[model samples]
Target chain A: MNNKKKIMEDLIHGIFLILGLITVGCVFLITVYLIISGVPAIRKIGIINFLFGTKWASTAQDPKYGILPFILTSIYGTAGAIILGVPVGFFTAVYLSKVAPSKMRQIVSFIVNMLAGIPSVVYGLVGMMVLVPGIRKLFNIPDGASLFAAIIVLSIMILPSIISVSMTALDAVPRDYEDASLALGANEIETYFRVSVPAARSGIAAAVVLGVGRAIGEAMAVMMVSGNAAKMPSLFQSVRFLTTAVASEMSYSAGLQRQALFSIALVLFLFIMLINATLNFFMKKGDVH
Target chain B: MKRSLYKGAMKTLMYISVGITCILAFSLIGYVLYRGIPGLSISFLTQKPSYLKGTIGILPDILNTLYVIIASLLIVLPLGVGAAVYLTEYASNKKIVGIIEYAAETLSGIPSIIYGLVGMLFFCQFLGFRTSLIAGALTLVIMNLPTIMRTTEESLKTVPNSYREGAFGLGAGKWRVIRTVVLPGCVDGVVTGCILTVGRIIGESAALLFTAGFAHSVHGFIDGLSSSGSTLTVALYVYAKEQGEFQVAFSIATILLILAFIINLAAVGVSNYYRKKRTV
Candidate 1:
């Protein structure tokens, strides 16, 4: 009986060992598959030129995978989102923790959480219906769907992530800090900026990082509003980013084109990993400070 | 005073920023309610999705969505909770614990598209499960694991040490102590985590697109694993993109928004209640 029990214990342990191994295996498999697919494509289109070129003619008999323009568009779109989202998110965190009534805070915070849970496709639908029409009518842009549209959509999409994380951070600030600031004759705004926010700096920074993750990962909404044009993205000119580039072509793409699409997925995966790790490092270091 | 003027400008900007965040979120909700609220009928909730345009019944998609969520939770919750327990209750070494925590957090932050790519290659190719509900649910399980682990860990941390001590004093084994004492005490936390995970799953799109197969069909409970089904989110995506059918997408959006909003509101409330109870 004891021997049988011991064997059962070993079997259960082995199950866990395999499960853990599979998680690690999946990550490695993705990296390897992506590299094999991407490297060959990069060689076909000279790595230097492909990485730096502006034109993206994906349909030529001998096509070019010059992703520099798309890469640049992604970088700046994320930058636009972060710049638009973080300050507002930070202040909302301030207002919720500092100024808002309890009822108002509860309602607003719930709204933010719901916003975070909203599927990207829903954002895409609404953006097309409301924001696109509004942009076309008010701005007199020939195409309502443009890089600017992508930026605005991404900014809104990332808000729930930014606000919730920052709110948690701000809530971490002890009331003692606010009391101390008040004792120093500083007004509420002064105290919030100088004392409370700084005290919650690490949390706020984490919020920004989370925001970056959300904005970077967003696909469906941006694809809808980004015009699907593969030219280099100018502020108002429409262009395709990496995600749309993949989604737009996936259903029909086959052979080398499909491989190249996976290559885009590879590059996208690496880009997000870099952003997350950089933020993680910042958060860790800030905590240490 | 110049300082007073500076302060006034800052206040105005701060308020505006807060207002902007509110409006960004509210506009989506308001738009959905304004359009969808009037069209929502009991019949709309009771029938299946159709390729036939103009009729707005989402019964099949709603049932499919619920099937996927419940199925995924059944797979993930036990596994996630067990892993959390092992890390928290059994593991003694700080190094191992830290490694587990770090891995879970990093995995949580990975983009769902990456998961889509992996699901396509690993599940569809290696496992021989074509895009179906099972595949999607398994992928979602991976997606929600870190959430459950992190949240359950939070709740476990809040559980007083005395409960475990008391159980052990009665000669209860480790598993028994956890089953009887720790698990019961942490029920609210687990519920909160479950709610949040449900919210995440309900809203997910890209990952499902790869694994759940885009072909639309209604599947019975056990057969649900084999058939292709569209969740409400994907239904909205298809309508918005390929068909350029905006109104249907908005109506779908309205349904998703209300579902997500209700769940989220509940999660926040239960989490707050538990948190307050623990403090006392």
Candidate 2:
């Protein structure tokens, strides 16, 4: 009986070890695969031009790979989203963290979690149906789906994440700062921006970086709205993101062309790695308490 | 008076944004309910997606999704728990565990779309799996592994050391104590992780795009494995794009969202039950 038990325990232990190794191995293989396929494409495209060029076309013969245009659209969309989303989201966090009555805060907090739970594709669906038409009729953009649409949808999608994190950060601010400022006779808004905001700057910065990461890697939602144009992005004009570039074309694309699409994936992976790492670093740095 | 006016303006902006957010949620739900419910007669979910497009139903797509989740969970759940057991129970070195923890965290940050690319190269073309349900299922297992491992680890850690010591007093082996005591205590947590894993897989699109192709409907276990299957989310996207039939897209979106919302509530319900059980 003891011998049988011993065998079972050994089997379980081996199982645990194997599972751990597979998790490690998957991450290891993905990095290796990205680098292996990416290096040659990077060499061919040249680092500087690939980052700076504006058009992407890969065909039977010659291929042109310039990600600058897509990179530009990603930046502009993220920036626009931040501009639109941050003030609202940050204030919403403030409402939840500091200002709202307890009942309201509890309800709002749950709602925020629900929003966070929503799939990004649903966000894209709402954007297409509601935001797209609103932009067209309200703003009168020629195309309903544009960088503008992507920005609006991305901002909303990112809001719950930003608010949830920023709220925690704000909550972490020593209560003494608010109490002291109020004791010295400052208004709520005044104390918040002057004292509380400064204290939570690092945390808020982390939130913004997270939002940027969300924007850059956002594919399906943005893909549905961004119009997938390979050209330079205008707010009203359509654009393509590096993440969407491959997903949009992967179906029909073949040959070296397929390899070229994989190359696009390589570029996107590297870009996300840089952003995601920086976000992690800042999040850790913000962990003062 | 001016200050009051300013306050009013700010209140308006606040209400508008919140209202819009609410409307966005409701509008999608409303549209989907309006179109899909009317369309989801028994016939719709029972038959294959007709290439005839507008008249196609998602019976096979639904079944394939169920198959993918079942297969993927079977592969992921035990392995995931084991990894968690080792990390939380066996490993004492904080630094070594920290590396794996951080790697898992970073992996979660990588977009699902990138996971699709890796799956394409590793599972589909390289391994010669072709675009099948298994291909998508395996990819999702990878996509969800980190989350499951982390959640399970947290659950295991929540099991008090007193239980282990009690078993030790009885001359039970370490592994026996873990299997008998800790595993039962952490069952709810493991279940939460699995439920969440299902949520992630069910709603995922980009990862499934290449691995699972975009057929409106496919049926049969063998056909689902060998043929094209589009998930609820992908179907929403396809209908929203090519069809522009907002009614159909809305209906599908409603189904996906409500399904997600329900599963989430189920996870929370489980967590609450566990919390209560633990207190007792």
Candidate 3:
């Protein structure tokens, strides 16, 4: 009976250990699969032309599989969103974490959670109808769907992440730091900006990186608002992102077209991995402080 | 004078920022509800679309969404909770813990569209699941694993060491201590994780688009798993984008919005209840 009990315990431990390792297994599986499938097309297309080519006419009789347009558009769009979203999110985080009364903070935080919970598709729908048309009328453009509209929608989508993450970081700032700043003759506003914000800088940096990840990885919303044209990115032009590039062509694509889409996905995966490393670095630094 | 000016400008900027956020949130919710609610009706929820009848419905989509949610949660809950339990209760090596935690973070950071692509490659083509609800559910199981593990691990940390020590002192085996004391204690975390997972599953579309092709035929759970179907979000995308049926899309969006609202509320309520229970 004692031997049976010990064996059962050992078996259960083995099972739990397997379960614990499943996430690692999954990451390995994805990386291997992406590389296996994504490498062939790149080998055929040549790395420089595939990554740096400025045109993407995959379906034409003579296809040009240049993805420079998508790459530049993704970079420009994410940068624009960060520029538009971070300050508002930062100020809002400061307000919520340090300035707002408790009840007000609770209400606002709930609203922020609601914002986060809203589906990306719904945001796409709203942007397509409202922001797209508004842009057209305001800017007197021929078409409403442009990189600018995508940037606006992305900025809104990333706000919840930036605000919530920054709030957590700001809230984690030691109360003693703020008290000392106040004791040294700093006012409340100055103390929060100088002391609390600086103390939570790493965390805030992580939050920004998180926002960057979300914006760059986004597909459906950006696809809808950004006009899905394979053009070099200008603020007012219809442009494609690396994400939308993969999504828009996947349905009816065949042969090299389909393989190239997989290659685009491979590029996106690499970008996300880079961002994830940066986020981890910031978070680790935050923990150290 | 300069200090006062700086203070006033900073305070003003903060208020303006708060104002912008609130306006964005209210307008989004208000606009979705305003446009979506007017198109919702009993038949729209109860029936599926018929090309012959010149009518549209989302009954099949609703059922598909339910099926995907149930299947993904059923598979993911065990894997996630088990992993969390091992990390918290069993793992002695800090390096292993760090690796697993890093993997979980990487998983969460990955975008859903890539999951869609990989899921298509792995489950649909490689594994021969085809474009079906089961494949989508499996893909989502991967997507939500980190969320469940993180929440469960957090609550497991709150389960005091003394409870486990006391159970061990009673001559209970390791598994028995966990089964009796640890698992039961983290019900709130599991519940919160479930709610969040449901919300994510509901919101998910890009990942499911290819892994589960957008077909609207209704079937029982067993059949549904193997057949192609669109969840509510995918159906919304199809209607709005492919079909130009904004009215139908709006109605589905309303249902999704209401569902999202409830899930968010439930998450907050469950966490608050657990926090109070622990204190008391």
Candidate 1 on B56-133: residue-level lDDT in tens? 567777867888898999988886777666666776678766666666666777788777777777777679888788
Please, what are the lDDT tens digits per residue for candidate 2 over residues B18-118? 55555654565565566557655666667765656647666766787787888789888887888888887776778767777777776787888888888
Candidate 1 predicts chain B with a TM-score of 0.93
Off by over 4 Å in 1: A1-33, A36-40, A43-46, B49-56
A1-289 per-residue lDDT for model 3 (tens digits): 9999999999999999999999999999999999988889999999999999988899889988898999899999999999999999999999999999999999999999998999999999999989999999999999999999999999999999999999999999999999999999999999999999999999999999999999999999998899999989999989999999999989999999999999999999999999999999999999998
Candidate 2 per-residue lDDT over residues A173-227, each given as its tens digit: 9999999998998766667767887888888888888888787788999998888
By summed lDDT, the worst window of 10 consecutive residues in model 2 chain A runs over A53-62
Pitting candidate 1 against candidate 3, the one with the higher TM-score is: 3
Ranking by lDDT: 3, 2, 1
How good is the docking of model 1, as DockQ?
A: 0.51
Q: Residue B141 of model 2: what lDDT?
A: 86
Lowest summed lDDT window (length 10), candidate 2 chain B? B20-29
lDDT of 1 at A150: 88
TM-score of the second chain, each candidate in turn, equals 0.93, 0.87, 0.98
DockQ of all models, two decimals each: 0.51, 0.45, 0.88
Error of 2 at A221 (Å): 1.4
Docking class of 2: acceptable
**TM-score of the first chain alone, every candidate:** 0.92, 0.87, 0.99
The parts of candidate 2 lying over 4 Å away from their true place are A1-14, A60-62, A139-141, A171-202, B1-40, B51-54, B216-223, B243-245
